[model samples]
Target: MWDDVFPIDQVQEIRTKTTVYLGAGAIKKIYDIAKDLKEKGVDNVLVVTGRSSYKKTGAWDHVEKALKEQGMGYAVYDKVTPNPTADSVDEATKMGKDLGANAVIAIGGGSPIDAAKSVAILLEYKDKTARDLYELSFVPQRAVPLVAINLTHGTGTEVDRFAVVSIPEKEYKPAIAYDCIYPMYSIDDPELMTGLSLDQTKYVSIDALNHVIEACTTKTANPFSILLAKETVRLIAKYLPKAVENPQDLRARYFLLYASMIAGVSFDNGLLHFTHALEHPLSAIKPELAHGLGLAMIVPAVVEAIYPASKDILDEVLEPITKGAEGAEEVAKTLEKWIFSVGVTSKLEDEGFKGEDIPKLVKLVRETPSLDGLVSLAPVEGTDEVIKKIYQRSLKPIA
Candidate 1:
């Protein structure tokens, strides 16, 4: 087993660029937030979001009303897809530039908010392409100020500078991590999540759960991350089932949203391992598959594969996740069972991937230059062949 390979000589500190406001109707704080930005000379703003849901959920109306009341000029870029692409970021940047947007406000889930982050940065880099952003060839000194009013409890994109942007043509999705892309602030109102379907709540909650599990299990796990991960795991294990069973449970939704932010901070600091690396290619190839479901499908397989190396840490975290389950294998089984109970049961085969797709996914993992950093963080050796075998294991039904 590889010992924790991170720099132990350097002390790890917890920090965040985004300040969070949380409550039942916390989204209403956007009105004052917009006014403050306007006072600070952010006159024209870009509102990045998805279609129909924002309107259907009344979030867009709320934001529109705020902008109108504040007399702030705003343009809406609402074409953000589930797995947002570099092309979409470029298009949104073009719109923000055309509208002379000096600030960005994002509503909806991770995709739109993440797109907003890239768009804000790209607005300043008129000469650079989204491809340059994805390739890390250029780093903007700053992004236009961003404010996120989260509509989903998942992604936690509102609180972090990282954005997962897809190069769909190449069948790759890599995170765009830069210092300046963090939001100026975030408003996480559990009320917004009330309209979510049970499936939506379950899948997104699972994504947050994975963030905690991945961060706690990574080589960089420290005092801060360990605390956050344990608390996040316990909260999700207790509240996610309740949220999934009763989508209108305000208590459940609130805690799940809290856990999402906690897990986001944990992973943002500790970084993730093979779970994200393995899950990325699946979604990149099948854009229709929900990101959380893709993570759900392969998480147990990767955990089981890495058990030999991660057992001690897995044992420590297993009780919080399993309540009483012990040992690495039992923890994995319990995790998978909990995932099944929560309603995500799709396998790679069920998602339309065949035996041939395994090699394709393996190749994508092997070829993704940026993935090497994340791949190297896995507790177990993640050789191309080992990654290929994990993908093979995922071909069977998860249940």
Candidate 2:
């Protein structure tokens, strides 16, 4: 138990090595870059795009046409899925090897981007097990270059070097990050997301908000991270609702994407907290509840759990979202209200989680590595009571 909150000014030693290509129609940049690659004699491009999105945008066909127009050789790898499993990785890796792809371009949401990154890493270390990659303790000495074309809101998954992978057979879920995982190109195209469902937009948008909140209030507090987190929360609060309410609202959609992009930058350093830690088990246990919704449901309570250490950060996180709530308590209270406003119908009971699973979930929490990283500076004891309290309080309906 920390007697006081952690003081933070600088978050991480951030030196951006990855190049970002941004525009309303960012995918075109891929065509331009591909042409440039050909000029430089780098051509074996593998296009890893979401199966659904590739069909929708005809992006695979578009990329193929673009490459063929330049007499460039490229392969389309369409084996992408949400919440990727090891089997998905194995399949994707085979595609990369068979094509002899020298570079990769992952199009569409976090799923395809993550899958493409995994495939690139796997190609270089064909001998390494999937387990080694997920652990991220070590990586192959060789890795192929990769680029990402991001769609959808939140997730900032395009910019980060981490990927959340699932093990359905063993019921394990781990977030893997490595220097090798960073995209050589992170291309943000706002128009590409105008087709997203309201639910998809809402969930992803909220996930970005949670990143800022957790990053700001966690045991690790950095001044730069806090400022970025605060600005991210303010913009998301201002724009997400409008974006969800009207997909055609181009300005709203643009700002939401912009905010998520900046939040992704903060995520590159500030890291996530217990809301993410506890959420992994829940998502692994029940795929129906996306990790984002899990964060929304648990975050109110997670907010309370960290209340002792950083009520001030919590208050600041909540203030803009709440529109001038009295103070930390009210701001925190407003967060609960804001969570509901965003359409998160989070009820563990509704999800069919039995009381027996509580202890099991608690065990997952206690054993989870580096969750202590979130509470590291706070001096937490890392016990069942702490997790149990969060679970119980999170289940309560917004009052």
Question: After superposition, which runs of candidate 1 have C-alpha atoms over 4 Å from their true positions?
Answer: 1-15, 323-327
Which residue pairs overlap in candidate 1's backbone? Answer: none
- Report the lDDT tens digits of candidate 1 across residue range 1-399: 111232222222223678787767777777888788888898889999888677877777778888888888999988999999989989889888999999999888998999898888988888987888887787688889998888888787777768888998899888777889899978888878889887789888889888877887778877777788888877787888888778888878888888898888888887788878888888898888889998888888887878788676666765656667665566667778878877887778888888887887888887764677888888777898888877777787544
As for model 2, its CA RMSD to the true structure in angstroms is 6.5
**Cα lDDT tens digits for candidate 2, 277-355:** 7777787777667667777777777776676677677677667777676543565567888877877766676667766
**How accurate locally is residue 60 in candidate 2, as Cα lDDT from 0 to 100?**
59
TM-score of each: 0.93, 0.89
